[model samples]
Structures are given as C-alpha cells and as structure tokens.
Target chain A: MKMLINVPESVVPDALRGMAAAHPELAVDPDSRLVVRGDAPVAGKVALVSGGGSGHEPLHGGFVGRGMLDAACPGEIFTSPVPDQMARAAAAVDSGEGVLFVVKNYTGDVLNFDMAAELAEDEGLRVAKVLVQDDVAVTDSTFTAGRRGTGATLFVEKIAGALAEEGAPLERVEAVARQVSEASRSFGAALSPCTTPAKGSPTFDLPAGELELGIGIHGEPGRERRPMMTSGEIADFAVDAVLEDLRPDAPVLALVNGMGATPLIELYGFCAEVHRVLAERRVPVARTLVGNYVTSLDMAGASVTLCQADEELLRLWDAPVATPGLRWGL
Target chain B: MKMLINVPESVVPDALRGMAAAHPELAVDPDSRLVVRGDAPVAGKVALVSGGGSGHEPLHGGFVGRGMLDAACPGEIFTSPVPDQMARAAAAVDSGEGVLFVVKNYTGDVLNFDMAAELAEDEGLRVAKVLVQDDVAVTDSTFTAGRRGTGATLFVEKIAGALAEEGAPLERVEAVARQVSEASRSFGAALSPCTTPAKGSPTFDLPAGELELGIGIHGEPGRERRPMMTSGEIADFAVDAVLEDLRPDAPVLALVNGMGATPLIELYGFCAEVHRVLAERRVPVARTLVGNYVTSLDMAGASVTLCQADEELLRLWDAPVATPGLRWGL
Candidate 1:
C-alpha cells in the first residue's frame, strides 16, 4: 500500500511528461492523449494501432514506433480509452495503405475500439480490426462476453507490426494477426489483488497463502482458487492449459508474462517449470520469452501464451520492428 | 512479507524453463545457462550479448532475438551470471564476426562478463565490451565504483544492437554502445524494497510514506531518502538532474521504466510531469516511451532514461532487429 506520489490524479499526466522528456523519437500529442512515433505515416505500409486501460504501461502506447504500432492511445488507469482517442490514433497512423486495430477481448475495449473504427471508416480511412481472445480461463459466452485477451496480444502486435512494416496489405495483416490469435492460447493466475491509484485499496480480497487461477487481467475472479503452489506447480497448470489449447505439433513460441507484482525471480521460476513440463510432453519450444510484456496493475500473477510458429510466422517474428516500447534492428 | 514458492534454491532454473516454454524463438542451453536466439550464430553478423542478476527479467535475457542481442546470460536471482555462462553465450552466438559484450555498471556483472570476455579472447575469439555508467543519482564515483547502470542499459543494447545487425564491426558496436552509455543518464526512486524469494523478505528498509531515490536495480540504497512527493515534483527533480548530466540540445529518446510493482498509470503521471518540465526548458521532445522495460524484483519504483539521438541514431533505432526480449521490423 506504499506509493510515492503527490496526488492520485497527477500520476498519469506526470508520467506522460517524463516520457516525452526522456524519449525524443516519440511525440506526445497532449490534446489527443496519443503517443506516436515522429514519422508515423510511413508512406505505403499499413499502420497498426491499439490501446486500452492505462495501468498496463508500454502495452499499447510504448509499442508505437517504426516496426510495431505507428501510434497508441493510453486510457485512464484501468479504463478503456475513449472513442475519440482511438479514432485519432487510427487516423494519425493511417498511411496510403490503411490501418489495422489490435483489440483485446474486453467489452469496454471492444465497444470503444469498434466505435472508433467505424468513425475512422466514415472518415474515408480504411481500418480493419482483429479481436484478440486468447485467454482460456473463461468459458461462459451466454452470460458474459468471450474470453478476455491477455498475453497473446503482445505476439499479435509483434507479428502484425512486422508484416505491416513489410508493406503487407491491411487484409493480409489482419489475416495473419487473426491466425496468430487462433493459434495462440493463454491462462493466468494471481496471488494478490492490486489497488487502483484512484481507489487507493485493492480491488479484490485475496487472502495470503492462496492463489487464484484463471484470473483476468483486470483483477477479476478466476475459475478456481487453491492454496499457493510453488512456481513450478503454477507453471505446470498454466503452461499445460495453454499447450492443451494450442496443441502445436511443430516448434512453438512461448510468452511467459508477469501480470504485475510478480518478481523477475519468480517469473524465472515459472519459466523453468514450464520448460520442464514442455520437455516432458515432447513439445518443441522454438523460442522463449519471460517478462512483463502484458501486465495488470501490480496484480501479483503471471500468464502463459503459446503461439504455434510456422515459417511465415517466424519470418514475421524475425522482421525488423521499432516502437517506443520495443526497438531493435534499425 | 508474502510469497509463493516450493524450494527457494530452484527459483532461477524453474523460471528459465518457463521462459523457454513461453517463448519458442529463444533456445535455452540449460547446461550452460545461456539463452540464445533460435537462429543464433546469425550467419554473418556480429553477436551482441548482455546479462546481469536474474531479477531484471527481459533485460539481458529477454532481449535476445532478431534485432536485439544474439545471446543473453542469466545469473541467479539478483546475482551476476558466472563467467562460464557468458563464455558459452559468446561462443554459441559468435559467427566469426566477433562479439560485443554490453554489460551494465554493476560490480558483479562487470566482473563476470569481463572474465568471460577474457576467456573468449584466450580461446582466440574477437570480443569487445562497453560498460554502462548512466545513473546520475549516485554521486561519489571517486570513492566507490562509479554509478550503477540501472535503466539506460536498454538504450545501449538497442541502438548498439541495431548497428551490429547492420554489419557494424565489433569495435564500432562497442564504440557506439559506449557513446550511448556516456550520453544517456538515468535515476530511480523506490517506494518499497523487493522481497527475494529465497529470503522471503525485503532487500532493504523503506517506510510507508518515504522513498529512496537513486536506488540500483538490485536493491542498492539510493543517494537520498526523502518524504514522498507528487509524481510531478519527483519527475522534475529527476529530470533536472538528468538534464544537467546529459545537457542534450537535440531531440532525445525517453524511457520511463518501472522498477516493478509500479503501475503504468503511475508511469504516465511521471511522464506527464516530465513532458511539462521539458517543454519549459524548450527541449524539443522527440521520442517518448513509458513502461516497465527493466525492473527490480517486485519493488515499487521507476527510472527515467534519456538518450541523445541524431539522424544516425534515429536510423539505427529504426533498423530491423530481432531478439526474444525486443522483436521489431524483421
């Protein structure tokens, strides 16, 4: 419950100013609330755009740059970005080709991004969107919406952005992005609840010595709760579920993501267990990444994402990408 | 302090397995404790390598991919990786084009990596290194070893990796990486100490209302301890110090990195204040990135990194690079 801040309201804006001062390659459109790469309208390439709640830093906005997203809209802490922000982001990053929107499977995000896309389309801009529903913890389609997109969204942006930079058309980019979504699967578990800056206390109650499996990124309840297990056991259940859902025969890409609050040491512990489980199952892991790629707001949990990699996927994966959040090969 | 684990000793190995399962593009040589890109020995490009304590996930290890580092050596949690691991990483990724070792300014990391480079040289391998010393908060390099490189190391790896991927010789990569190290500056503030899984307690003491500024990534005490301030005021002080150190007139690349446990909302708040301060100084804010790039265990802190960039640095920033931790335009 300890924090260093002047006031709760100033957290977001203060961070934005710090970012603008620190990174010169990215421009902050204060009025629009968008963080964009300087030369965003990159000629003929299809621009990729995404945004959501603000508590998860670098998820959407930080990934805006050369090889990845052209622009990202940061919403209020844990709240979806309004349609105006998304609409402007889509428009600013749009080049001659078109723009692609990568949306997580959350009601607020879906509704808002969908509205923004419609507005962009009305503006004579071509915008296509691929909804990411990679989370496997939820299964009720009648009462609630579909599974919430968790970790796989990172892979979607990564591959889709690479293809966009390669001058792939919007349709092709959307198709591959969707394929990644279809092939990817993710599940998460939480050990503690996180407090929203505005709220100042935890959103939920998670007693010590317990873990919530199948949790959502928003601090929502998971499918089950049990006594806390070692990182090895947690990795077993999470990676097993993802592997079962992905069912990959060839080598696969692994995205072991921390859902905020989990230490890097523990994440490595999770990764170690996952590798052992996969090895035991004879699953060929083509590559591996362990970090807080997609995170919640200090929600002491982690998620696992498995993407079945093909030659095309690997090529796209290897393609050059530059964004405020991720930059390499220039 | 609360944590979930089985045996503390197995944390790092378990995490590595999980990372391998989650990211298939990275291949883990468990025996050697080296994580290399699946396509390592990248045919004809100089290999780039980095590493340090295990707590900073996605740093030295997570950044192994196409456009970034060719290999990353992960040490035990908060402990530097041994020399053999770095030697193995250098050997596995070197394509006869030499290797550039990018090490942060930590005594353990520098020592182990230096020893490893010597070992590689003893075996007739071409190797060069750049020690990152960007943190301006910890003064008094005259008495102790210089400032501890915390967040700015990412900028060094990223830009230098781009050059190496573009066929820059080992010397050039090392030189440019050093230039980034010298030009960049970073400082951090921690609200709470991180609990090591093994220790099951915090690495340091922090009161409920105060913060430690200029802390290292591995729980090292900062230069000052002060009552917490608004995100804006904190951002101002941090920015002013960095501006004094960097004194950049051109556009800069900004990295507002969360140590861990700090939400994106908090980061944005920091960013907003930073932007305001830079505007006041008439510093043309060029590129801005806000996120949790490098992190401590589960400490609630954030670091600001500024890198002066010109046309060439910007071009290199845009170049295609692939690695597990950072994947972009390929």
Candidate 2:
C-alpha cells in the first residue's frame, strides 16, 4: 500500500511524536500513548479523558485542550487502548474535583475503560464514567456488543467538556455527558473501505459501483450494500436512519463528518443535501459542523451525527474550545 | 466515479450553498459564486479577495472571514474563475481603502485576476495583485507559465490578511504578500491521481505501487515516477527540494499539508519524518501546521511549504483569525 508511514508497528508512537512537535501546547507522552493538555490538573476542575483506537484521528486525542478533554489515550490502529494507559492519563490530568472517562461503546473500549476506572478509584481518585453508544445503525457489530458509538463522541466531548471546564462537580459533568449521549445518534455510509497500515490492504471488499449503508467506522458490515447512490440519496438514508431512531422534539446540532478521505468539497455538497433533508423533516438545526473530525483511516465516506440540543447544550457547544480538531470561540 | 456529489454540474453551486448554510458568519452568494465576510466593506481597512477553481475546498472560499480574505470566488472544478466573479467579489468587499487580489500562479488564474483588477479599477476601486509562485516542482508545467502556486497561497492570504486587518495600506498589504511569496517554497508528491467531478475519471494515470515526486496540484506531471518510497524517504526528498532553494536565514513556518485523501494519522507520521529532516538540516521551525489545507481533489499524497519567517511574519501568523477552514486565537 502506498500509505505515508515508516512501519506499521511505529505508526502510533511516531504520530504522537509528530503531534508533540506540531502542537507543543499538548504534553504528548509517546511511551504511554497519552496526550494530555499542557497545563493539566487544572485546580478543582473536572478533568475529561477520552480515547479509543488509533486510525480515527482528531477524535479523542485531537480534542484535548482548554475546553475539551484533559487527556487522551490512543491505542493502536483499530485496537483498544489497555487499562494502564487510561489509568496513567487519569492520574496525570485529574485535579481535586475528579476525573471522568468518556468511553465509546465498543466492547473492547468499554471493558478497558471500566478497568481503568477501577484502577483510578483504587488509588483514591473519584472517577465517573459515561459510555457513548449513539450509533443507530447497528444494535451489535464486529467489535461492539451494543450499538457502536460514532460521531456523537465529538458531541459528548464538546458539551460535557464545557461543563467540566466550568469547574462543574464531577457528578454534574458525568450527568451532562450522559445527557448528551442520550440525545445524540449517528449513522455512517461508506463509498470505499480503508486500508490499515499493518494489513496494507483494504479491510474489506467493496467493489466499485456499490456503497455500504450504515457501515461502522471500522468497516464493520452495515445494514446493507447497494449500487452506488448519489450524495442526496446517501444523506437521505443516513439522516433517515438517525431521525427514525431519535424522533427529536428539540432543535438539533448537526455534524456531517468525513470518514477520513472524503474531501471538503464533497462534504459541503453532502451537507447541503442533509440540510435539505432536515428542512423537509422540520428539524431546526442549532449548529452545524462539517469536516473530517472523527475519521477512519483513508475511508472515503461520511457520517451524520445529530444531537437534539437544548438551550444549555447549545450554550455549552458555543463555549470557547481550543483543540487541534475543533477550535472556536476562543 | 464513486464520488460524493449530485450531478457533476452542480458541484460548485451545491457546495457553495452548503458553505452558506454551515457558516452563517460568512455571506455566501451562490449566484455570483462568492464567499464574503459576514461583515464586509469595513471602512478604512484594506480588503483581501482570493479565488480559484472549485475542487480545492477551504482554500480561497474556506479562508474567507475575519482576519483573512474579505471575499473568495470559486470557479468550476479544475477551472479558473472568470474575471466577472473576481471583479464582483472585489467590488463587494472593497471599501474606500481598496482591495488586494491573491492569485495563484496558474495561467488562467493569473490572467483572469489581471483582467479583474482592471475591471475593479475602472469601477473606482483601488486594486493590487500578488501572484503566488511558490512551488519548486517545476519552472512551468501543465497549467502555468511559472512555478505552480500550491501551498504558499495560504501563507500569503494569512500573513497579508493579518496586515490588512491591522489597517495597513493597500500597497503595504500588497508588498508583504509579495514578500511572503518570495520567502516561501513548496514541494509535493502523489501516490495516486484524483478524479474530477466533470471528468468522472482519474485526472491522470498513476500506476499502483509507484509515486510521482514534485507533483503540481492538478495532477500535472511531476519530476518523475519511481517505485513507491517510505514516508521517511518521501519527506527527505520533499524537504530537500524545498530547503535547497529556501536556505532560510530565519526560523521557518512549516506547513505539512495533505493532498486530499491522506489521513491525519499518516500526515502526523509524515510530519514527524519532516521534522526529523528539518532538524538534521538545521532549519529551525517556528511553527508547524499539519492537515489537508491546500488539496488536489482526492489525490493521495502531501506537500511541504516552508516560509522563512521574521518576527513580523510570525506575529501576523499568530494573530486571531476566524474562518471556516482555519480558526484560532480569539
């Protein structure tokens, strides 16, 4: 595969080293695979720590900074980080207030974060946990025993991180995180499968002229595969899947996220169709974000995440955030 | 052509419409194909107007907002925007203070921007132009009579726009734009070719297991295609090409930009290799940005742009600017 990497084994550590160089503001620990805010352990502030496998970049690690996660623990490509990494990050970033672990719904992630929470608690640190299972596409998937978390990981980090940054109590921060998680849902469709550095080939066979609807971020089998569809059709299906699962009465925060390799031009074009679909469905969108925020490695597709936002959630989302992936109002 | 688009003909307008919908802070005019700052025509401040072909998203259009371009004009995919679009954007954003046009070095862009300057001048608006010819790949290639302007367009717009935002005169803004262009040099490599919406096929053939070095952004022939090299080798080659001519006397601002379809993980790993090369060459980097900033549709590769920065350029780069693509500091 013609991918940009020295060797498959060195991908995560090399990238962490690069991240440290590019963003000196983050305290990157390549050995422990932890990326912590430069000024971590902010006095009395609830520290947010979230992470998952590598490959889906700018998700957990790229979201660590002033108004987001206090630390992140990235695992190998498409593999869960062990409990030791998470426990080390929690210890590094936790202030007197407490630590909150934002774990996605994959079985590996949930289990590891669970063990990490216990490990931190055993050390006299108060740790709260919230699992993000916002993907409406599947009830169970290849790596997940429940609905896999997708785009709402961003929503959870931003909204809840805002509360945490405000020096909210750990329980309150945990509540807000769970609240955002319950209010969000995501669906993804893939135009192409991605290749892992280790595998050096596409994860699966997705022949030309066909698209996978409801595909998981890890290229897990989706609801179905059909002949290639236009952007409008895909948006309609993805949005429909999300809205059907979450018949929201409140206005929504929309995320039209690129699955790694989709260009911005197409994302914007697809976003317009999403807006059209939402308008027809009478859902007022409070805020919209479009980009490769949470991504699979080089997969050419997009995921739609919608959070039914209350005034409080909107205010939280609008707060200043200074992460490498999502920066605004700072 | 498994791409995310409606009808190929609707790509530009659709994306523009989506841009408007997504960024309410920017006034996007679909009819005129312009993205203007929501608060335009700021009196007594020089304005920056930039535009080019449509496929490169977040370039000219995404750069339109506070502390950046006052407006951007987007043309059809892989095609130059006409004089009318640029002239209209110039007129729409120009206050009595005047407007500066930032044009890339492609022949159509330079020629049409020249015509647009005359049109705007005839309309009683002071117009100045700066052509970015930063690519060291070739002296002249498929779409240009000089080195193809690739990544340095971002540096010019950002540095010069910061100066303009500080109420600098049009001539001064124009001068620094030229200064930035002169100080900057870029080199690119491609693993695969991109497919345009209208063409519905790969722009050019790039056989598997090979790569083209010193590639122009539009899939133009580079120096040569060789069997694929590792990321370290590519970084060595790309940085060598840039620093060979730059030979910086001051610390440099480095932009390790992905040519669409390369993931952030790989970009960061590639960035580490880039840093290693620069460190060994003893070229100090003042700042580094890693992402898909300037892109070639969905081509898989990257470009390295290095600008030797003095204190003034570094200050301008650090200033607060809010835009869809690049947002930070206030």
Candidate 3:
C-alpha cells in the first residue's frame, strides 16, 4: 500500500497519541478517541462537537481549539464514530449553555450522532443537531444515504463555532450552522483512488488518462468518467456544479480544497481558475482558502466549496481561530 | 502522470497568481516570480530573502511575511531560479540596513544566489549569505554538491527573521542563521517517486513492496532500496542517522515533515515514533512540528529534522508571525 503505518488496526490510536504529543493545547481521550480543547466546556458558552471518519484528517480532530470545535469524536477510517464516544464528549464539554452536534449527512454519521444526542439528553444535557449535506456530486453513493457532506463541513464548524464562542444560545448556533450548510455547495474530481490501510489496494480502479468528475469523498461513483481535462476545464466543472446548486450574486467565501495527495502548487492553480470563473459569472468573493482541508486518505483530487457569506458569517469567520489544521487572526 | 495542472510551462506562473489571489497580505511579482510581504523592506530592520524550486510549497513562498523572509524568488518546478530574479528580489527588499540571503545548498541554488549577491553588491546593497546544508542523507546527490539542504531552511528563515525583526544587525542575523543551520540535521525516506510536470512520468521507480531510505527532495537516490519496514523501524532509522551527526543533550526542536503525498494521519503516527525514539535517547524536546512543510511534489514519504534549541531560538520561534502557510501567535 506504500503507507507509513504500524499495524493496520492501530493507526487510529497511534495517531491520536501523536496528535496529543504534538499539540499540548489539545486534550485527547485515548479511551473514547475524543479530542477536546484543554480548557474545554467554556463557562456559559455553547459547546460545539463534530466527528466523522478518520481518513479525512484535520477535519474533526485538528479543528478542536479556540473559535472552532470544542470537542471531536473520531472513528476508524471511513467508519462512523460509535455513540459512546460522542455521548462522552458531549457530557464532558456541556456547560450551562448546552451542546450542538455538527454532523455531516452520511447514513452512519447521522444515525450515530442521533443516538449520541439521545444519550446525552438522557443525561439531562441540552443538545441540538446541525446536519451538513452540501456535496452536489451525488444524492446516494457508497455509505451516503443522501447528498454527502464534503467541504462545507469546515464552513459550518468555523462560523457556528465563532457564534458559540460569543456565548450565543444553542438554538442560534444551530440556526447559523444550518444556514451555512444551505448556502454552501461542493463538487469534487479525483485523479486517482486511495488505498485504505487494511485493504492494501485502491478502493476503486481509475485507469490513467481518465478523470472522475463529481467524485464523492470515499471514491463513490461520480457524475461520469471522462478523458483527462485541463486545469481550467476541471475548475469550470466543479465551479459550475456549485453555481448551479446555488448562484451567488453576493460575496461568497470560497475554498479550493485538496483531496489528499494533491500538491499545494496544483491546488493554487485550480483555485485561480475557480476565482476567474466566479468573476466571469460576476459572483463576488469575500474570502478564499486554497489548500488541503478535507481529504480522503491519499486520493489525488480537489474539491471546490462556495458559501454565500453575509456580514455575520464573515465576521465570525474573521474572528480569531487557533487550531492545528486551521489557524488565523489569533 | 496524475497532476492538476494546465500547461507544464505555466505551472509556476499560474500557481503564483493563485497564491496572490489567496493571500492579499503578500505581494507576488509575476515578472520576477517573487512573493514578499505586502509591506516589505521595513526601515531599520535587516531583510531576509530565500528561494528555490517551485514544487516545495510553503517552504520559501509561504514563509514570506511577518517575522520571516522579506522576499522569496521561486524557480520552475525542481529548477533553480535565475540570477535575475534573485537579484531583483534582493534589490527590492534591501531596506538600507542590509539583506541576508538564505540559500539552500544545492549546486544550482548556491551558484545562482552567489551571482545575485554579487549583482546586489554592485548595486551598493549590503548583503550576507547563510547557506543551509543540514541534510545528513547524502553528502553529494543529484543537483547538490554537498549535504542537500532540506527542513532546516525553515528554521534558519524563521529564527533569523525573528532576529532581524528585532532590528539586529546583518552580521548578527547571519551568525544566528548559521548557528541554526549547524545545529539542525535531517533524514528522509520515500515510498514512491514524484512525477515532475514536464517529465510526465515518475522520477524513479520502486517496486510496490520496497522503500527508499534517505531519499532526496527531488527524487535523488538515497542510502539504499530495501523492503518496506514498519513505522517504528523507519523512525528509528531516521533518528539514528540524525543523532549520529549531532547528539544533543539539551532541549531541541523537532519537525516530522511529510513529503507531499503522505497523509497527516500517517505523519502523526510517524511523528509519535520519532518522539518516542528521541525520548528513549533521553533527548529533551522543547518544540515539535508535524506536517508537510518542505515537500517533493506528491512524493509519498517523510523526513525528520532536529535542531538544538537554545533560549534565544525558542524565544524567536515563539514570537508572533503571520504568513499564508505558517501562522501562529498573531
């Protein structure tokens, strides 16, 4: 598989230990695989929690810090975290304000977070759920029961986390999370399939000279496989898919994210084309992020995410955030 | 080759445009291929200038901003920048105090930067050079005449930039840069070869089950090709190579850097093993960074860099610096 790992089954635990060693500000629970801020459960503030599979790194775990997720529950690669982990994280991080569960809309994730929320409520803790399903790639594929959540999960976490930090009520934070999800749209293209550690082979076969348009995070079947296209063409495909889902005449926050194994140089070129296309369509852009944020193990691809940003969302995004994966203004 | 690029020749320029678009705080000169802080050439402070091939994202370009390099001259992919570009950057960033050139010890880079420094001197600009050759992988490899410079370039730029920001003289900054370069050492391994854009093929070939120990950043031959080893064994190989060169009894700064294609999850696990080995050796670690800081384009491997950190270097590292790729304490 050409992967740098120990035993396949121990990847998650070993990485968690490494993460704890790297970032002293984060407190990792080896028992539950939950990563929370050292000073978590801020008094009188809403606690934001999110989680998903482990392969898409820096997603839920690396985002746990100031002005972002308060706690994150991580599952095995491409598998949903169990309810016990989420329940424990929720119970640990819930101050008086309450806790909000920001979940991506995949069948396993939704069901697991639901179960955890119920478990937390049974413990007399206030809880709310915000589902992110912004991928325009497909409605049902692989593990997804509906449109799978992709890059917009970052937007929901950042914007909603900012509101939570400001001591916003649980209901208000959930509303903003939903707003970000609705306003954002994402589309991805894969140049190569990723090999999971246990499998030791590619999840799917993609012959050379062909590209998968609108591919899902887990190598799910996309819109179609076509001859390799130019960077401009690929950027147009992703931006057009997003624009079709939601035409943004107002200023938007755009993220040109890499699907693991893609270099930053290519991501920058793709991002330039995306902005050019958006400008040609007369869509204003308030902020832009170009790098690998959400990834699928070592897949070689890129995803474009656009979220229609209002004043409040922009302000929240501009607020100070200090995390291992995403840090700025702090 | 599966890369997201338009034309092979346009990769550098297109990516520069994208970087300029993504980061408005830095000014990118399309003609000279220079990325510098928007408000550069601060009066009374020594200016820092560094550059190299383009594929190593966030190394030279992304490190340009507050408390780092004043300007970075980017060359073509895996090709050194011309003397003209370096000369232009040196002239532009000289704030009358002086400009210090931080050159990685590749033959092409050293020759080109030397010519540029002479040109800058003819223009009556005070300049000093600090060459980084901290890689213990090979004394002479493809494109390099001596020890190939790798991760320590980051430490030199960061620590020296911090000193310059404090209004230190040119000689003092140069001395500190040399100290950092001398104190740091690195070793690398690659699971797969990187395919250059122009070549449109892998730089080298390795069977699926084998690995290259101490591979160069540009796919140069390393110590040997051997059977794939476990992560713990690989970590030991790297740490042992570095420790052989310099044994540190004091607190040291450690960096576990991924070479483009490696996933962060693996990096964390690998980083954990590196720290464990260091702890076993009774090395006190004051700081650690784990990510793709210096990379070969989409190469699946990693490198370990350790620098003996004194109080001055630690203080400088902890100072607030804001840049596109590396940002903290802002």
Candidate 4:
C-alpha cells in the first residue's frame, strides 16, 4: 500500500495545482477543486460537464475539453465530490444553450450531481442529466441501487461530447447520451483486489491463484470467483454476457478495457479472444477499441464493452471528440 | 506477478483467436501472426503497416484499420515480431501502389522491422520506413542507441494511417509519417516495474517510496529515481520535457498515456496539470488525450506526448479509422 506523496491531505490540492500548471487551456479552481477549460463559457456552444470519485483517473476529469465536457469536479480519492464543487463547475461552463451533466450510475455520483443540477437551476441555469448504467455485472439493485457504469461511460462521453460540440440541443445530446448507455454493456474481471488509499488494505480477499469475474469498478465482489482461466475463456465469459444482453445481428462498438494493472499485451490478448468469440457468432463489429479507458486503482483486471451502433450512431461516434481523456481528429 | 491464465504459452494464441472472433471484420492470419481489417488493400490505395514487441498494445497492431495502418504484426510479449511475420503482413495488405512501415525507435523493433522491409522489397513490393525517435527521456544517443519511442507512436499511427487511408501516394504517406515522428516527443515516469510473463518477476526494482523518471517503454531504467512525488510533479516532469522539446506555439495534441497500472483519475489529474503547464508557456493546445495508449506490461507509470498538428495532419487524424484497437468514423 505504499504511495508517493508528501501528505495524504495534500494529494488533491497539490495535484490540482500541477494539473492547471500542465494544461493551460484548463482552468483549475483550487478553492472549489474544479478543473475546467480556460474559456469558461464556450461562447454560443452548449456545455457538457461530468465528475465523480477520484480513483478512476481520466474518467470524468480527463474528458473535460473541446468536443467533450467543459469542466470536471474530482472528489478526493474514492470519494464523491461535494455538490458545491459541481455547482461551481456548472456555473463556470454553462452557456445560454444549456448544460448537460454526464453522470455515472453511482449512488454518490448521482446524488451529488443531482443536487448540483438543482443548485444551478436555482441560479437561473438550464441543466439536463444523462445517467450511465452500462455495467451488466450486477443484477441486484437492492443493495447497490443499479448496475455500475464502467467502460461504457467512455462511449457516452465521446458521443455526447461530440453531439454537444456539434451544437445539438440539450434534449438531443441528453437523449443520445442515454442511447449510448442503453446500447452499450460492460463486464469486468479482477485478478487482485485494490487497496484504497484511506483503507490502506486490500478491498477483499482474492487468493493468489484466483480471479473475481464480473466485478464492479469500485473494487466490490463480483458474480463469481473461480480458478484463474485462460484469456480466451475469460473473454468468452465476459463477451458472451455482454452480447447476450445485447441482441444479435446488430453493429456494435467493442472496448477491451483494462481494470488497471493488466498489461497492454494481456488486454490485446483479451481483445483478440473477444474478436474470435464475436466472429464465431457472426456479430457485426462496427468499431473496436482496446485500452485502459476506465480503470480501477492498480487493480489487475479488464472489462469488455459492446455498444450497438447504427448509421447515425456511427456518425456521432466518428464525429470529432477532444477531451483530456479521449481525443481524436485534433 | 500473479496473472490469470491457464498456461503462459497459450496467452498469445488464445488472445489472437478471441480478437479474430470479436472483430470478424478484421482479418487475422494465424500462420503469419498478422491482423488486418477485412477490407484491406483498398483499390488504388497504398498500404501502411507497422508493429513491434507486443507489450505496447494498440501501437502497431491496435492501429490497423481503414484510416490508419492496413495491417499489424504482433510479436511475442515485449519482443519484436520476427521478420517473417512482418513480411506476411506486408504481403497481406500491400496493393500495387506500395507500403510504408512505421517503426518505433527501439533497436529490436527497428532491426526486425527493417529486415522485414528488405524481405518485402525483395518480393517486388515498394516499401518505405519512418523511424520514431521522439522520446526525450534518454539522451538522444548517450546511454542507448537513441531515444525510445513511447507515446508519440500513437500520433504517427493516426496521421500516417489517415494518409494511407486517403489513398495518398506512398512517398506522401512516408513523408507525413516522418514529419509526425519528428514533430512529436514523449517522456515517462514509473512507480513500479512491469513483469514480463517469461521472466515471472519485475524487470526493475522501484523501492516502496521512490519513482523512476524518464523510463523507456521496455522497463529500462529511467534518467532519475527519486522519492515518490505527487501526481502534479510527475505531470510537470513529463509535460515540461515534451513542451521543451517541441516548443510548440500553434495548436498541438497532448497525450497523457499510462504505462499500464496507473488509473484514469491520476491520468486526468495529470492532464489537468499538463493543460496548466502549457497555458503558462502560452502554448495553444488544440486537443488533449489522457489514457493508456502505449504501455509497458503492468508497470505503474505514465508518459506524455505532444504532437504539432497542421491542417493536413488534422484531417488525417479525423479520417475514418477502424481496427480492433482503435475505431473511429464510419
């Protein structure tokens, strides 16, 4: 559980300073703990904002940029950002065209962002929300509220950001974001448990030669724990679950994302296996991506996401997207 | 070093099968260890091919698609794919126009890819090469042969792939690829070493509370090892080095790439820091990206790359790209 830092309390503040220092285009509000692009109100464009816990690097924060989110509020490590921070971000990026909040389907994230949206509304701003619930790992909603948003969050950010950049109305952007969430499904398997910074211990007991399949992004236990299997077998289990949830004979965007510690080689192997599995089923893959898009903190595992895409969805997917987390087309 | 696998030797083969299955549109030649899109060798278009060791996922392999490379050869984990594999890939995707090889500046990668190019030429195929030596971490040619290509490879892949996809002449594509490689630069910092599957142990020792700055992609020792610093400092070191090398005043593309184990939250913070740093220098950053693009096994570290983009480069970056690793535009 060793980490590199002068003090645990300064991790967030010091990190923000450095972030602002490195990305001049991004404006960092130390007091509010928000990072935003220098041009607060993007002129006549609709603004997109997203934020969540801090453990998942590049998720809500890295996605703040042109063709994506206008700002991001990063909470302390593994903790949700307060409503005030989100409020500040909303105020900073809101344009007359309105603002969209891209929230992950987490209790803390949803509640906090909801409160912030209300606060912004009180301040005479228009805000809409798109909740991302793409993770198919958990079926029990009683304890967790809903399925966790994992790799599919990226699809929402990329597409919604693109839509917003193209000056789509808030309603259209929110609808498209929701569509991405619906069309996309994700599942993860972790080989090792992550040790939270505050807890300073393993989140759960995963024996030396075992894996937890269908795990949550927050390091929670999964649907099953079995003897470690081959990458091919793991791919079969993960991909089949996602494909089963999504209908057959549809074009889909595939993502083989690393949980955290898995090597690119391992992830590539996983993607390779996923490709083979889909080919056998005669699935039409419209697009494919393999990388660490959404990640756990040094957790040795990976996730697979399949987003069904039609011509319009594909066009939106291909549209220019510029974010700190996902950037393309310059 | 506890990996989830039925057998170490079967990792690559099983992964390949899964990839071919999942991305049926992307063709995989098991015999040659080559992966190409189903619609490769487009009529009257020059073919672009690239590859190297397997650890840096999505580099030469994940980039094979419509707007990027036509084919990719996956070598053994962290080892350059042999010349025969490269030859096979060249043959599979080469049209009557010609082929361009985008090679990272690793000695093994350069040697292997160069040999493959010679073999392809001997087979009566016109071939050109663009060697990437953008990493500024190592003294250009002091400790090693030259700076190791790390994150900048992505820019080369995207821009070069775009040119090839647009049916640009082989000479034009080769020139564009070379321009990208020269204009881009990268540097990395690591908290821990990545373990090679064959080795079964970390390649280097990173003391519990220390970090290695300016490390190469192959787990090579970095320029400096200091007590672990905050994420901001890490970002500063990497961003400062890249900006110093590029001195870009016009809009540029910024990439904050995780080596492997670092999470997205940290990368996001790092991106924010990078944005701040560039702004201070009055550099106009056109776009930003934060993720795990070029990685080193499961190393806990990150690298940053900066690419100067002009109109032509931007067009290529925006063009449709489809591959198992990166897919965009229809």
Per DockQ, the best of the predicted structures is 2
DockQ for every model, please: 0.44, 0.82, 0.77, 0.31
Poorest 10 consecutive residues by lDDT, candidate 1 chain B: B139-148
Question: Model 3: runs farther than 4 Å from truth?
Answer: none
Q: Which RMSD does model 3 reach against the true structure?
A: 1.1
What is the C-alpha lDDT profile of model 2 across B260-328, one tens digit per residue?
999999999999999999999999999999999999899999999999999999999999889999998
Best by TM-score: 2
True-vs-predicted CA distance for residue A300, candidate 3, Å: 0.2
Worst 10 residues of 1 chain A by lDDT: A138-147
RMSD of 4: 4.9
DockQ of 4: 0.31
**By TM-score, how accurate is candidate 4?**
0.80
- Across A1-330, the per-residue lDDT of candidate 2 in tens digits comes to 689888999999999989998999999988889999999989989999999999999888999998999999999999999999999999999887899999999999999999999999999999999999999888988999989998999999999999988888999999999999999999999999999999999999998999999998898999999999999999899999999999889999999999999989999999999999999999999899999998999999999999999999999999999988888775
Query: Mind giving the per-residue lDDT tens digits that candidate 1 earns over A77-159?
Result: 77889998898888887886888999988888899998998999999999899999998888643213888887888889999
Shift in Å, residue A236, candidate 4: 4.7
What RMSD value applies to candidate 2? 0.8
lDDT of 4 by residue, B110-168 (tens): 88888998999999999999988888888653224887877878898888877777778
Model 1 achieves a DockQ score of 0.44
Clashing pairs in 2: none
